[model samples]
Target: LPFWNKGSHSPSNHVIVAFEAYRQLSQVSIRPMTAISSMANIHEDICATAKRKEAAVIILPFHKHQSLDGSLNNTRNDFRWVNKRVLMLSWNFC
Candidate 1:
């Protein structure tokens, strides 16, 4: 799934990333379902999407805290919490 960054510094980059990911996955014969949302509500959006789509798994990227340039830092205090929440919520679906 793709998370939409509504007020991000680089919004177009997110689209490019999503498209590239879709292309690579398509090459492997794996079609992925996608969704978009702001970083703040991504956890809730993911859980809602999973329920709506009846998804068994959710894959998240570290891009939330790290940029495409591979810089690693704690950009958001809730990043860890969001990760944990997504993992726990996905497990409940499974």
Candidate 2:
């Protein structure tokens, strides 16, 4: 396994960490759970799935890279736009 540097601002590494954490948590939690495996067109897919299943809450993870100085370095513009749109559309249900 590749090790990430402490306070690394790598988006891919962050995603890997997030998924692993979620996996571990799911194993110990007794509540029912579902994992969406696809990443293609994620924004659209998540919205469609939520609407179809009438999901109570949709958790969207935003990607951000922080520098050693504790300032945000690179932020994902695509995710930012998608999150905004999804929040707007889901307002009625939320």
Per-model C-alpha lDDT, please?
0.67, 0.63
Q: What TM-score would each prediction reach against the true structure?
A: 0.45, 0.47
List, residue by residue over 1-94, the lDDT tens digit for candidate 1.
Answer: 4544556757545655675677677773333655777877788888888788766556665434566899777766666778877877766766
Q: On residues 2-68, what C-alpha lDDT tens digit does candidate 2 reach at each position?
A: 3435687776566656655665768743222345644445666667778787666566667577889
Q: Which stretches of candidate 1 lie over 4 Å from their true place?
A: 1-21, 24-42, 55-71
lDDT of 2: 0.63
True-vs-predicted CA distance for residue 33, candidate 2, Å: 10
